[model samples]
Target: MALNNTYGARLVQQETALGAGVQILLLALLGSATGMGPAGWLTGLVFAVASWAVLSRAVHRSRLSSFGPANRVTLGRATLVGGVTALVADSFRGSPPVTLFVALTAVALVLDGVDGKVARRTGTSSALGARFDMEVDAFLILVLSVYVSAELGPWVLLIGGMRYAFVAAARVWPWLTAPLPPSTARKAVAAVQGVFLLVAASGVLPVMADAGVVAVALALLLWSFGRDVLWLWRQSRVVRQQGAGRVLESVAG
Candidate 1:
């Protein structure tokens, strides 16, 4: 048993190391193609190191014997996201290479669909894989939002920050951590955030039209989050009431 655990840990470390290697290689290519600046290099390096560390820890805790195919797909998507993030950071120095940025983001978003199917088909789905995928999706949207915010306004940040905000709120209100019932609508709303942001970033639309598209995305995200929060709040209230009822019964007895 101990030997198996050692093997699993070693395997996870190797996979994450390989992921970091890929991230560095992508950054090198971006630098060569675009003369990416120091900010881009720094940001990409930070992302690679952080991703490797966090993913290694998570997999170790989950005790997975192998890093599965679905996770590898998600990791690849994450590498693309790192490139996109570096490009966004570099944009502050000058105009971004819009075509390259869009291409990387597009591939990442498309692969977002592929990972789940791979997981379901392979029967290797795990909580760690799902969480890894969700975090990558969220970070990519956040990066895209930052890029668009430069054009639209800071108000555009709400689209990127909402999920992180919810996570912070959960720290205070533990009930917010409760498992939400799976809603297809919620998933759809989450999926479109990237698409909407990508369109806005593509610079093809008129400013007014781009703002409108992002505004709609924010509204949908607001509604989806509001519904989930309301559900959790109601569930918490029911548990409290049931606890009180039990106390009353015991007192009566």
Candidate 2:
């Protein structure tokens, strides 16, 4: 983690360099305390560095408006993810470590929304901030998905699958690089999905008991995506019509 952090052009930035150092140090402490040994420490340190790199960039770019609050919250979220991961790992005995992982995952998921909102509210919105937030989200989700899939046999997880699918499609279709634009409905669905996932992961639900609950949540996400797709299609038509009408008016005038 230290080597990679201080490597390349990224070291040119003071914030990145400093954040990396801090991350490396903390990761060592985290590993030593958790009895995660050298390997686990290295893995966790890598994650910590990644998170620091992102948040530091966001800070340096001045994209986060409510830094006071956002920083505190994100730090908390990070602690939760790392702490719970260790706890669950230690309890490799009874029940699934799914509960700890899920709880940690929830914090990461929730932080996604909180950071965005804070940026908007504090008028600190910027490309750097968005990118930082997005990277954090992608990494968190990816890690959690990998862990979950390892624990619970993969059924049909769109969280990880959708990201890979979109990325692959983007490579083949240049136009896929264009964003589909944000939608509140999509955000709502994402939030709900996280909630249900966390709850199920807590192991609070009976093995067969939460099946209906999980199913319903999945259905909701599907509907949300379907609705948003239709809305975006209509919006495209409207945009095209407006452009055409403007051209005709200009020609006539």
Best by lDDT: 1
Candidate 2, 1-253: lDDT as tens digits: 5556444224335444554565565555545654555445556665666666656665546533334444444455564454444433444433334544564576677676787677678765656655555545544444444344444546526554555565786587544454577777777766665566566566677755445555565687678656655665677678779999999999999
RMSD of 1: 0.8
Q: Whole-model Cα lDDT per candidate?
A: 0.96, 0.56
* Quality of model 2 by C-alpha lDDT: 0.56
TM-score for all models, in order of appearance: 0.98, 0.63
Clashing pairs in model 2? Answer: none
